[model samples]
Target: MRARLELFASIRRDARIEGLSIRGLAKRYQVGRDTVRQALSDPVPPARKTPVRSSPRLDPFKPAIDAMLVEDTTAPRKQRHTARRILARLIEEHDALELSYSTVRDYVRVRRAQIDVEAGRRVEVFVPQEHAPGAEAEVDFGEVWIVLDGVKTKCHMFIFRLSHSGKAIHRVYPTQAQEAFLEGHIEAFNEIGGVPVKHIRYDNLTSAVRTVVFGQGRNRVENDRWVLFRSFYGFDSFYCQPGIAGAHEKGGVEGEVGWFRRNRLTPMPVAKSLEELNDRIRYREAEDDQRRFDGRIRTIGHDFAAERPFLAPLPAEEFDPGLVLNPRVDRSSMITVRMVKYSVPARFIGRRVRVSLRASELVVFDGRAVAARHQRIVAKGGQSVQLDHYLEVLKTKPGALPGSTALARARASGSFTSAHEAFWAASRRVNGDAEGTRELIDVLLLHRSMDAADIQAGITAALRVGAVSADVVAVEARRHATTSAAEGGPRSDRHRGAHAQAKVQRVVSLTQRRLMDPAAVIAGLPSDSRPLPSVRAYDELLAKRAEHPAKTASKENIS
Candidate 1:
């Protein structure tokens, strides 16, 4: 094409500029006179035209093929007639049409694509919506595969996007359960500082929708708890149609999930923990605030700031986003919550307790008293046992203390510091292993009332004095705790016994030391021996030199 255009251009230029005859230009360019005459008439190269051929047999059946292709758009995909079937129909049903299968196949291939293009152009189209600030929002959940802490893990990301500003809040969760769904809404609302006034659009997520009535326009049964949540926030909901077809209703957040994942979470985020991942997400969101979306004149942060005042004010109190469960504590003192088991007090075993499960923590309540609280474990079948909950059981089964989950957790949390370990080892050397472990459990029980550091420090103090008894550890812990309280500030309640006298004596001793000068105290110390005086030989030499300056200068000059 390039060579042909160049030849044509050169022929035209020579003919027009040099005023050469067609025959002359043909001879110069080594081409025929007709080619040169054509180039001279048209400055641009002529496009090659496809030769038209008469296919007398297939031409008559072209209308039937076009109609079949057009109707296939509304027909079931599998039921649509194939090219071979269409050919058979053309010969058998329409006797007048006479064409071979090969000829029909070649013609139908090009014609079918044309029909599809026409059908697509005639398909349903959406009108662009103009949303008001703080009046509309969209909520959706998207799946993201992230490498969390070196492990390739799949997680659900909840995306909440304000339609007007294109501002979005995204959070990752291990599961798209009802609890996480509700919690995501709570957090997103708090972050946005208000709720959308008109309607927050959502898909037919099972967390929010109990049932969807087919053929009913936006008429669906919503979840009870979800209804309450929506009522509390004072926002109406517009549920999109179910499945892929309904995705466009909440398109803002749907696109946001992909946009955010590609821009911020791409290249795979590696973090030590989920909390660390969330912290990174927070920083990414802050960075995103400065960026403007395509076709938008203002940045998201700027638009959100202007829209914030128009949003509905928050309710007086936050909604409780915890899902309530009543799981019976097993003989092992563990209650299952979301497939993960957490240990409560031993006394709760064989009984049902109320488990309030939030996204991050699970609180177990025995009637009015809180039995246990554990950081919610995301992994299934994982156990989170508090040693304090099993102390009573450990007291009876000292042999089990060596491999108990409670003990491991205590060590990991530094609640059972090395001081406790040292005390236990010394106790074992003196009182034997089982007895020592039992004694250690007794000291661990003290953590329920006193601070772990105070108890550990006391254990250290007791061990320094070569005492291994739990009683000695208790006394040391109490003594230091009391001293810490007294030294912090003035005593709230004055003691009137020997203990009070000792505290008063210590205070007086500290005051007297502060009042005494260091120099006087050093002078009061007894000397081992008296030092000898040194001679003033250097001073006498200086006096003689000062008296004979002129004589010494003359003597030095003669030498």
Candidate 2:
């Protein structure tokens, strides 16, 4: 009976046999049914024996097939056909006539075991751990829903955890913009009261990974701006590959991310505003610091307190998350920043203005004083502030001009209209010439000062006359000069005769000088020389000589 167990084992091991029935085996051995049945049913034990000959079908290409199978198991099943295809290619191309499809399949199965063993041994080699307080931290972002302005809005959750102490900080933001990301870091650092010396590990979010280079050990990171931000804040970043498999490295923050959303934001929390919602999240986060973990003696706050000493001291100046953009004011005295137009004083036209843009508000300054302020509007290409905003100041001191260049630009841009031109023209009339034109322009600018009516009238008068010339305007003014004598004004009739006699004497003197020296007379020489006798004076002297004719006759007789 014991020998029968060996016989049954031999039969089972034979390649030609499959299952050996008890009845069939009994008939073959010429034994009683019970005896044969017992022998057939008995489990076969292995005897120490020499190894059988290995299959020749699988022997030759075993190593190559095993390598293929090992690599295929990690790949998709559709790709496993590559193994069968390669086997077929070997037969066709290399005259491998003995290798059939079934033989190749069995060989591949056998080789797979050996390949798996090799692959299992070749895993990532991890270094032994040496944990230090505040040496490392993990960071990640999650999403949460909270009531904002009476409406529920989804927001991003930023979570960070100290690897050694298990201390954690969490914050929520309306957006995941880069500014918000950096700001969240700054706030987290402040809450922890220090910075971590070891690298901060995070999943490959766009803020960290600029591009992923396939097969390379490292990918290109964000621009220098982010690098400088990290350097300035005294921390380093370690970005994991961008998938669930790579996220295990940052498990600390990953757990914290879900924990924050579930514990703080769930159950439809309500808030008056986004800021209020953030305030509530902040309060909950602070409260969370007091909680203890399983088997830990200290609370998260206590762990953080102990870890604070190991962290680097915070820098003096806080990080500025605002973007600095340079924009030039167009001819319209308006600058476009982030799609919104802000008007500076017209004087700033054509000059470049620097914009320190934040998420919620825009503040414009000229040197130091706030030149303009506006609520940030997200739309593109529209004025955020009106030109009329600074109109009063421009009117008060027209000489404090943005200059003719700015005014001309404003006019060209339709900011200054035909009405403004009319007012300017009237002012020119009141002033006369280019000088008057300039003064009239100053008056029209009084769009801030004198009544618009008065300015318009002045401009109309100035244009009607070609008082376009200041000199012509002066002459017109003299012709229109009024005298007071006709009314209750000064009486000039009494002095008229004296004025007439003085005028005649001046004419007589001028005529005598002209006859004496015509060229010098034209030159208007001074009357220092003796005056010539008048024609009337010569006639009088001749008459007197004739009266003395009798005496002359007597003198001639004596001669």
Candidate 3:
């Protein structure tokens, strides 16, 4: 409008200076003659008048709509009548036959706003909270979808936020299981190097809350593990009210969860493995230290530094976050935990073994010793089988060795690499099927005493020389093992010395047997190397000696 006024003024000035007519001024300004005359008369453009619309068809129902709108202010927020409901009620009981839905909708929209303002409904107000450094933090879990190694994966993110510094830690896991919940705390505490203010606030998550007490003011029965955890860390737990009312209690972490996802995990990060994804998350957390929250005068790194000194010093030892279970090894020498099967030693079959289940690992214990450790499998019906666990049983039933799950997993994991495959093929050709499998089992047992790389190197070396026998593979494997031990320098510890001695014994025993075929050794020798001896030759020699004993004696001496 201002530009138009300026243009009209310029045009009038030009007309006065050059003596142009109104029609010429109208054409120059791209306006009508009347517009030019109005512009010349008034220096400012007229204001635009909005069209006045009326809901004539809805006039009879106006009182009812206003009544509903007025009553809605005092009614329950959720129970308030929506426009569609009001429309239905109007058509049903009010006989608003002539009213179109749009007419009623338009009136209701405008009328509700007016009623809300008149009734004093307005935007919510939040108090600016001042948190003491190392005094407060919030915890929450959020869902994240990602693509892992080309497969779509659903994961949960455990978010922790320090109230004072606004420093956050993000860790993702396969599930929001109890173990993961505890593990997230342990990891965050370790990363941050201290526990936040004495009180850590949380929603009434099932992992922490045993049962929520209704009609009580934030009073609830907490899980025993949760109690123990907070006690170990010397912190207090505060449960938020149930549902929407509780969201604001831990608002820092609630907002941080979405904030981190939008800024860092947007577009759904792609990673080959969960560990890789988590490493990336930690690196991002470190990078975020350089940034500051809104309204803060200092960077997150600077704020955290100021708060670090006030934070509760770390415990003398970290808390164990694993869940312990005693699962009996099944007939298959497997123990089921969290619906996933993991193989233990076959000897453990029918016996219960203590299993420690972490978020990413399963460790089996027999008596006080670690029986086996496996990467935890999250998928239902998934199995993590160690080939070494079944070697003893496989030796007696070699037929099962080829199709066993443990063997398949081993092959897939490169533990049973081409070296093992080549050795098995050669052994099968040289020895019968059962015997060859037994020999292979013996070689597999070597993994318990020697490094897998050393064993693989030995297999490659032996295969290079056309040696397929288990004895030959063992000899080569031990040669490498011994060389490795020597290069690793000597150890004085009793356990290490004992292990070294056992390794030496194994190498000596393996090489004590013949590595070459007897038939092959003799195949290249001459066949007719035996002399045509004779009884006649012996008689003639005796007669010559009798005839010329002295000559024979001299010839014998010379010879």
User: Which model is ahead, 1 or 2, in terms of TM-score?
Assistant: 1
Q: Clashes in model 2: which pairs?
A: 425-459, 426-458, 426-459, 427-440, 429-462, 432-470, 433-469, 433-470, 446-449
Q: How far is candidate 2 from the true structure (C-alpha RMSD, Å)?
A: 25.9
**Best lDDT among the predictions, by candidate number:** 3
**370 Cα displacement, candidate 1 (Å):** 3.6
The best candidate in terms of TM-score = 3
lDDT of 1 by residue, 371-399 (tens): 78987778987989888999888888898
Model 3: how far is 515 from its true place, Å?
A: 10
lDDT of each: 0.81, 0.63, 0.82
- Candidate 2: where is the Cα deviation over 4 Å? 1-74, 77-130, 213-216, 329-335, 340-351, 359-365, 368-559
Go through the candidates in order and give the C-alpha RMSD of each one to the true structure. Answer: 21.0, 25.9, 10.1
Residues 1-559 of candidate 3: C-alpha lDDT, one tens digit per residue: 7787787688778777988889998888788888788777877877768899765677777889999999999999889998888988987998776776777777888889888888889845677788999999899999999998799999999988899999898898988888899999988898889997579898889999999989987788988988999889999988888888778877889889988999999999999888999999999998999997777788999999899888888899988788999998899999999898899998999999998898778889888899899987789999888999999888889999988888889988878888799778767766768988888899898888766876887777665555566676767766665565655634222234434443442222222112333332222334333454468757887777688778778888999
Any idea what lDDT model 1 has?
0.81
Which tens-of-lDDT digit does each residue in 179-232 have in candidate 2?
567777887888887889887887766765677676876565566668888889
TM-score against truth, every candidate: 0.69, 0.47, 0.74
Cα error, candidate 3, residue 30 (Å): 18
Q: Where does the lowest 10-residue lDDT sum fall in candidate 2?
A: 477-486
Separately for all candidates shown, the number of backbone clashes (residues 3 or more apart, or on different chains) is 0, 9, 2
